[model samples]
Target chain A: MTSADETQQRPAGDPAGPALDRFYTVIPAGGVGTRLWPLSRASAPKFLHDLTGSGTTLIRSTYERLAPLTGEKVMVVTGDPHRDAVCAQLPELDEADLVLEPSPKDSAAAIGLAAAILHRRDPEIIMGSFAADQVIAPVEAFQSAAREAVVTAATGRIVTIGISPTHPSTGFGYIRRGQALGVEGAPSAHQVVEFVEKPGEETAREYLDTGDYLWNAGMFVAPVGLLLQHLAAAQPELHAGVVEIAEAWGTERQQEVMERVWPDLPKTAIDYAVAEPAADAGDVAVIPGHFTWDDVGDFAAIARLNPAKEQDAMTVLGEKARVYSDQSSGVVVSDTRRVVALIGVEDIVVVDTEDALLVTTTDHAQSVKQAVEALREKGDSDVL
Target chain B: MTSADETQQRPAGDPAGPALDRFYTVIPAGGVGTRLWPLSRASAPKFLHDLTGSGTTLIRSTYERLAPLTGEKVMVVTGDPHRDAVCAQLPELDEADLVLEPSPKDSAAAIGLAAAILHRRDPEIIMGSFAADQVIAPVEAFQSAAREAVVTAATGRIVTIGISPTHPSTGFGYIRRGQALGVEGAPSAHQVVEFVEKPGEETAREYLDTGDYLWNAGMFVAPVGLLLQHLAAAQPELHAGVVEIAEAWGTERQQEVMERVWPDLPKTAIDYAVAEPAADAGDVAVIPGHFTWDDVGDFAAIARLNPAKEQDAMTVLGEKARVYSDQSSGVVVSDTRRVVALIGVEDIVVVDTEDALLVTTTDHAQSVKQAVEALREKGDSDVL
Candidate 1:
């Protein structure tokens, strides 16, 4: 069955029996957007900006997009700096839905945290992990695909929503789809064969042409039992650490367990620590997401999502404001109480704040965090 | 002989040469620096900035550079908007020396005005015309060159100073030098065969390899009578009108003559109006410039003049700074309040102003005024 193009077309009627009604969303908002510096500082990130002028951020927009599939069953896990902003921006999510990370860690830790929290609420809970920074369009289709993924997860297989590859993008990792999985009427679900690292452009082009490679969008759906079993079998150390942190969930000893366990845990991505292992286990399933998706990694990608009036331009705050951005372009944001002008410049970013100014090229936007490291190296801790 | 760089050296044996010498200096300060825009505005040019860190603006610096030969013999002729700045910067010059124009009629009118003024003072007075933005090293050698030119001008010939080109430069016009025509012991001065405009890269390289072409630095010394003779013979309208204006100097009616005459003056270069014709007249001579000279026309030229510390990069106002400016260059005016960084960018100009900001590629710096035009288009008059 084909889903409508517009997001608002909710399913009017489904003569088939109702699907599993126990899935909940877990938003990993703890990741920092180091590449989009100045705009995306330590206090804010890509998910926080109203990128599309819809008066909503990516996190808030993503939640609204999933409303039909799992109404009011979402949780946001963020750090201290963004905790207040997340709550302030999304007043609908109560304090209980906001999971605080004691310190910054990888997505694996976040997955464990989400699973533990869901286990406490319901041991058999179907959990779907969503990244706050991703953009998924055609909401109705995403909802339908996600609903199918949740149903597949209830069947004891770890399910991931793999985005259909639209281009030969070298920015994202690829998921090789295998033999077709059983979906009553949905063409979006498949059995995942393998997970590949970010490939060369030539290889990515091949995958795009083949139509079997799906972008590993870093979204997944699984039952608490299934995830815990995978973690226990594949990553026993992480499983033990998660268990320790979860046991201290509602006590004064919570910070103690977190502090002791987090720093010592291995730093790895969920793809390397779980998805790759799951693919090897031969039981993992892939749900091909029938939606437009973007992981705003750098200025080039950000410019694409917020396409300029011209071929490669992107405007930020002021609508009347004009930009001559190329595929390699950023902007000049001046707080000088006067109009700022940038001419004949490409690939560079100039972000002016009330007190501080950042002028660097887009290729170096990711290394801005290294400036903080430099400050620390020189013992200029105050700057950091 | 190539002279050693020494600034502000004068006669040890003949100190009191010309107390009120009839030597006149004409400053062509009409250019709108689009490359250095926001800093170098339409109202303010590079000659107004203390760009060299010697406590003098470029105009003031040029004045200081010529102080040895033309002691109190300076006259600054600029457009109406920059008249006050020119006057305010060079306080030693009288109000009469501050020649204001209705619009930028260019070098032809400026030279004509200088000739008229100097002719009024003394028909045989030697006049030296200098651009307000050039940087001349070794003031001592520059004065020596001017002294030689003044001696040559006393014989009623147009003495143009031709600098020995250090590279195959396509930026400046070239003067093809003929056989030498100076005293036995004096520096080499040749007859100028022809003046060529900025050439293509290959032509410039050919000119450089020939070793007979010197960069036409736009500096010239000639007697008022000689310039007046050529102007009357060729551009008779401009000459006749300027002569009427000169004869009625300091009278209430002179202002009328200026208003009536200047508005109708042909828009042309002094090279076209006098030098090219004078070459056919066989009265133009090229004296080799003793001092190292640079026009500081664009950012690339500026970078070549002011080489970077580590390599050949130009860093301006870089303070408490860690910079890696190289073949990929930019002006980094560091605010101690903020850390500025750049990477993988080439031929860029970054200017930080209190009310406006400008960042442009050096190659595109010429179009930076277009950014100002854009600001004007957007009705941002204050910033423009």
Candidate 2:
């Protein structure tokens, strides 16, 4: 494996910090992001887009955010179709660190494969798995929380960075924190009681009032060998399949083994395959994340993250000069390189792409998935 | 002058009947139709578009509607820029009958030029001036009403077609019909008391309840000599300029005379220059037209005219198969040859053209003119 010093040619605005020893960042770069249709098509998913108008793509931002901590120890696991796109967007990623899945088998298989590969290379390595399409603010805070999670994971426990709830949002699952672990160098680390599914409005409010639940942002950190052992006990078939593929990862049999085993791996999220079972066994710990984080699940969430300056001003995600709005408030995702004019439309969302255009309201942002489904039913595979 | 029989090679679907002898139809085609922007621009105005999706352009439909009444004696007066497009769309128009204006000098100048030329050729000929961008249905009713108006005009009266009001619409001016003229060939012909401007909502409702007011659709019919006489009395300078141009119309000095006098002609609508003053003089007569007529002013009017089958369905003006709507109700003018997807928007008006896009609502349809004004201010003449 290449040393961290060799990959430390950092960009100007990147966070300057010392690289953590034995720390590897694993990014699960998938999900079609259907709620952001026309802008987030299956051919070019959300991870590949600069959705926040931040000049860099979401995956690129993810890589930049973690590069100071992981350096050359970063790996990305994505499906075959997006392998080239992922590689193109992230040129610094080593060929050996980019894992191309033969087929999608949900989070458990994708993340588990990365953990098994890193464990095989360095048994004592601590790996943190983060989604490539999420947004986190205040790099210092995120780095601090990640450091605590890594420290907690070194004690042979599966660690997750639980985001502190800013509001009673029902869009994300909740993690209920129990007693504090009182471990050295990790003050906020606590034993996780359970992982709960997304709740109703009233239940979400109740959870917020109790102050025990934190938004489960799916950020997991643990020793690579410990995660593989948990996966081996909970999902033995999926674990064995990924381990077999990981064993031939850098060899001539890598492609052959991936094709034979990946297709048969269990199609399940890591939460269902390992996290919940590990919490039941009292092996799960959580470090409360003080930094702001958002999954950017829909345009409404995106609007919330990047709000308009005025109350009724439109939030544009592309060239601001290309959009003209009058008496309208909402988000506009413009990539068509054409002028988009909105008049007297309140809370409207306009997304302009090359082949298709979407006109909806921020309230109907989630229903954009149905539009993608309708397109699929109509055999619009070119756009899909 | 070409006789009616010499110009009777009408198309199949045209109103089939004997052409009215000594009658001429003068269509004034102008107006940028800025209210329907992106779809209607200066280069390609509303009259040139098949807005109704009825396979024929608005001007061609106007020509087809009046073919039975005017035959080959039809004349279209339009701006010089649109002369070639008009001739291309209307193949049957005689070269001598297509009057090209030097520039847009409003309806009075356009119609006066046609009348002066027709009067010079045949003094006793009856002429009817109609707009090229209006939609009138039930051709037989329109023809019958037009024939009566022509008979009324032969009596040397400035005859106009007053459309019977279907609703209390404040978007159109009203003509108060007084005592009947009781002419031999015209039964529904009445003396015009006055021509009122577009009224307020309450005034419009009162006008509809009175049963004495009819919508002034700007359809005027009169003898060519009588119309020239009215113009000479009401707008002497405009009438003199058009007459000078008409005198040199068939001569080699036609372009020179037009350039010398046309720009100096009064830039006024026919209502102000002729109809209003003529009504005040008690020289105007109206023939009540029972045919349905629509100016197709804005997207709201278009939505009302072409309502979707379902209550919450989207009304598409282009390929309906290319539009996908879910929980939305509105009008979509998709001329870009791309798929338009609407999700959870109500009363939305989306106009997609090749160069620009407009997203507004039915309530803000009139404000689209503001968008055009803004684009013009930005010097986006390519779209304007």
TM-score of each: 0.73, 0.92
- Candidate 2, lDDT over the whole model: 0.86
Which tens-of-lDDT digit does each residue in B1-384 have in candidate 2?
233443453344333222246688999999989898888889889899877768788999998888766766789998889978999999888888888877788888999999999989988888899899998888789988988888788777898999999899888999999999987768899999999999999999999999999999999987788778888988999899999999998899988998999989998888888888888989899999999998888888788877888888988887543788999998898886677899999999998887788999899999989888998898777788
The chain A TM-scores for the candidates, taken one by one, are 0.84, 0.93
lDDT of 1: 0.71
Instruction: Give candidate 2's error at residue A285 in angstroms.
Output: 1.7
Count steric clashes of candidate 1.
3
Candidate 2 matches the true fold with a TM-score of 0.92
Going through the candidates in order, their DockQ values are 0.33, 0.75
DockQ of 1: 0.33
Q: Find the candidate with the highest TM-score and give its number.
A: 2
Q: List the lowest-lDDT window of 10 residues for candidate 1 chain A.
A: A1-10
In CAPRI terms, where does candidate 1 land? acceptable
